[model samples]
Target chain A: MDINWQFIISTLPLYQKAAWITIKLGFWGTLLSLVIGLVCSIILYFRIKVLKELVEIYVELSRNTPLLIQLFFLYFGLTKLGITMSETTCAIIGLAFLGGSYMSEAFRSGIEAVSKTQIESGLSIGLSQMQLIRYVILPQAFAVTMPSLAANCIFLFKETSIVGAIAIAELMHVTQDVIGMYYQTFESLFMLVAAYLIIILPLSFLLTWLERKVRYAEFGN
Target chain B: MQNLGINVLFEGTTLQRLFEGLMMTAGIAFISIIIGSFLGIGMGLLRTSKSRIVQFICRLYLEVFRIIPILVWLFIVYFGVTNALDIHLDGEVVAVIVFSLWGAAEMGDIVRGALESLPKHQVESGKAIGLSFWGLYRYVLIPQAVRRMLPGAINLSTRMVKTTSLVVMIGVIDVVKVGQQIIERSIIKVPTASFWVYGLIFILYFIICYPLSKLSKKLEAKWEN
Candidate 1:
């Protein structure tokens, strides 16, 4: 496999810019999804009437569809309805729309895992509903949900690759651009794989460490 | 925008093309699932084997697939390998190969989870009955593990189906690509064609995946009870 190291070196700046965009998308996408997920889970836990069912339908619709189609629909389809967004905006929205449901599912499972007896005890101690959820339920659910939440975070980051489809200059986009320009397919792919590994491996370790910290604090094991 | 009726969806054999695209997507997903299941079951069995080397290899395979996005893998097989090695491979074939490998890795993990979740007594009873290792897996372990594996397997199948859309990136004319084509052809005449086209594709995917996901959930709930 003949790899052009010089070509790859020349393209480092392009990749750095693309990687920054990817990182930005991942950051914003994960944050939005987390907020959306937490809110939806809270709504479900409280059993809110119309909103609860709306959240359920939203979750199913988003989760059942692929992110690529979602991006297309958002970036291409929605423009027909006179709602326009920049590619990055559309990508972020697409990521959150998909990731929110998965994150909500993770959080819902975590909430369900909080034993009924704990909620009852918190209520008996005169904690209001909001306080009960805030102090008693969410902390435990957050701890139990940490692992899946971390997984979802990584999933969202990896998913940023799809944003390249909508013309966003992310890592995959840059890699493809390099290949197209230089015909350095091997070098371009090598850089692509390396960039993802460099970002993902460290993130994976950091998240694993964070998960362990959460578990230890919660369960003392 | 006023002419954005359902007519655009049916214009010039658009639905037929979309149907063909959907079939392509489904075909890739179906073939991969079948092959991946077989390979996965073997890898999963090996993963749970007593040998440390076997376990480590399985873990490595799973992690590699897990970390990188499927799009990268798709590009590697479809473009990188073909271009770098100066070989020819159909876009669809590369998609199948990559998805099969991915599906195997994912399914292997699922199978491993299902097998490991089986209680110790299941293995012991087979041994107590003087069964050989293969006989034990055949009669006792597999029968029980299959039950536990079904829901997860179904879930994985749905995921494979969804991920198949990524094949469009490799220039495979799947449903998403078909929608794009329809939109590109009529963008000027039907200003809102993309809305209808991509919307239909979205619903098409939803139609295929929703029931499977529901079925997975149903089986999981039923089995849990």
Candidate 2:
């Protein structure tokens, strides 16, 4: 296939702009899930009966269903219920919700990775439970969770592109828009793939570094 | 529309609907696994290649597929390539292509893990026995590696089945779409309730997915012995 160099370059600016939106969506969605997943994990870990049960049902339900359905139920179904918002908001919420389910599982495993005996020892030192968790338990759990957490971050980054289905001006959506406008479909899409790689590959490298650093500091069991 | 006893799912057009949906879901899944397994094995070998360039390329492929969301992949194959070619592809065929791409990346990782887990002595012994590379892989190395890989393959195959539901976004009319269609139509036919139809769809998915997940687990355990 003859490569049309100028067509691909001209399309680069459009994809670059779209890449920013994908990054923005990933950042906000991951931030929301970080909080929700942490809280849900804490509640579940503590054996808080009502909260734990609620988290269990939520996790199971969300994880089992396709994220597309979850997005549809949230974006389309909720709009019918008079819950209106911008496309960006819908994308962020759906992504965060799905990520939260997976993140909760990741968090739970991390907590389990932290030995119970260590937690008991911290408590037996007469420290309050809060101090025990903050000082002893969470640090180790967080370190253990770094690799999987990074993987999840990358996952959410890719998922943000799915918002294009609902017409958010994310990377994939904007690429499609350009393709439609220009009709240089091959060039536009090749640029899209290149655009995605630039953002995502760097993040993957960053995560690998972070994972190694965490492992070195904590010395994982 | 006739209810035989306690809302018989397998009755008349409803029976046909359920069967068709189930068939489509299974069809997409089987197609993905068959295509994906070959691609996966190819990618996995690429990943473990001694050549740094091939290894780097495989890593690039793995990273792109691993990180990118499945829906986005679905959109790309279903929307991007098809639109580029200006050809209207069948939803099921497109779904298979999309999922096989995803599944192959995942399967490559699994096979790589199995290969890595193998003892060095096993390979050494094969080479020491004067077997050619192909003969060694065929007769000795692969037999054992395949056993290690099967459970993980089973796990991913189940995921591939459930993931066919996502193809509904492109209007494949899989069970998920069928349910959505029924739910939408039910508003006029049975104005009293529509959530029930959607709820039924949800349960059908759970019924299919949960059992397969359990089977994957069972295979993992049985093979561990």
Candidate 3:
């Protein structure tokens, strides 16, 4: 019946430490996924013969299955193949693979959004394939995909909580541990919610701003 | 192959247990999606309401649910709130409630987008015909909105199905949880149990979700046409 503000306040330091870990996981996860997604999208855009189908299958499998199961497969199934990694490494890799699938879809759409005429024009100017991609395709695609990329980043941030299931000592994991020690379930969860909102809300605002800026740059204010 | 031992999947009770878990997963996702659609429609209409206070409340609901991860929300309901209130609800009940809450927020956004995208003159024409607010929505708005909203709502349904896998964290005995248990129990007897068990779980989810996602894409393309 009684709420404990004092207890919640006192636990802020512990939660803050966990929050830092979450942010780190999210940062590295998003970065890794973004690179993977970019490569996959570029490969698909160029229509690489054999690897294209393989990449499509990878994306479909990751997209279709649950992240938890994917995490489990990497964490548990990999052990059968004699591949061992720490919980944190597995969590980061799992998140990257999961986020990469979605990111590749977003980037594919972005690349497709670039007009065919642009590439043709670049070719007519004697541009190499690489030059055409660098000069004519990627910039515009980056602008088009920025919003979705930002949204994916936020999704990855929230997904860091799932790492807790694998005992990665992320935000949710630490909060659960704190609850086990003190039994302040309500207070701890309330603080956890606040911690996530604090990170996400500002990130969302920044994304919106960046989206607008990109739009303006593309079209003029 | 010899080192892996005989497959235990088709052995006595293992298949039945996995089937039950699969059914539980389907049942929870189905119930939550249906219930969440209704709640979402209500919230979505509220979001587009003319009243400022109603709109603010709707925005608050969407923002809070969207910001927090569903796992955290599930934990709050299953562990935190229940503990505080001294209620002993079943894990399935908690999963349904948590998933429904998530589905509603997502579907509400879909509905709001669909409704808002309508031409303003359609509503003006309804008002010009001297129709009441209820008549306007029933006769003028909802019919068109439903068509536009179908693909998005279905997409949300697919997402809910995938997201429900998190219920294993709360001990829901869903397919993932069952797989976890099977692997844990079979480790001594079959060293490769986790590979088969988790692989089967992945396939089960892929079967359920891949078709729905494909259907969603088809519906989206159809609508686009």
Report the number of the highest-TM-score candidate.
Answer: 1
What lDDT does candidate 2 reach at residue B84? Answer: 65
lDDT by residue for model 3 (A1-221), tens:
67799998898898898889999999999999999999999899888999999899999898998888888988998787688999989999999999999899999998888888887989999999999888878888889888899889999999998988888877889887988899988888888888998888988898889888877325421
Q: By summed lDDT, which 10 consecutive residues of candidate 1 chain A come out lowest?
A: A212-221
lDDT of each: 0.91, 0.77, 0.87
Q: Which pairs clash in model 2?
A: none
The residue pairs found clashing in candidate 3 are none
Give one digit per residue, the lDDT tens place, for model 2 in A1-221: 55688987776777777888889999999989888899999898788988899998888676666565566666655564457788889889988888898788888888888887788889888989789878887888889898889988988887786677778887877876775687776676677777777888899899899888877536545
Candidate order, TM-score descending: 1, 3, 2
Clashes of 2: 0
* DockQ of model 2 vs. true complex: 0.27
- Per-candidate DockQ vs. reference: 0.86, 0.27, 0.80
lDDT of 3 at B159: 82
TM-score against truth, every candidate: 0.98, 0.82, 0.95
The model with the greater DockQ, 1 or 3, is 1
Winner of 1 and 3 under TM-score: 1
Give the share of true interchain contacts found in each model. 0.88, 0.26, 0.82
Candidate 1's DockQ is 0.86
Candidate 3 ranges beyond 4 A from true positions = A1-6, B2-6
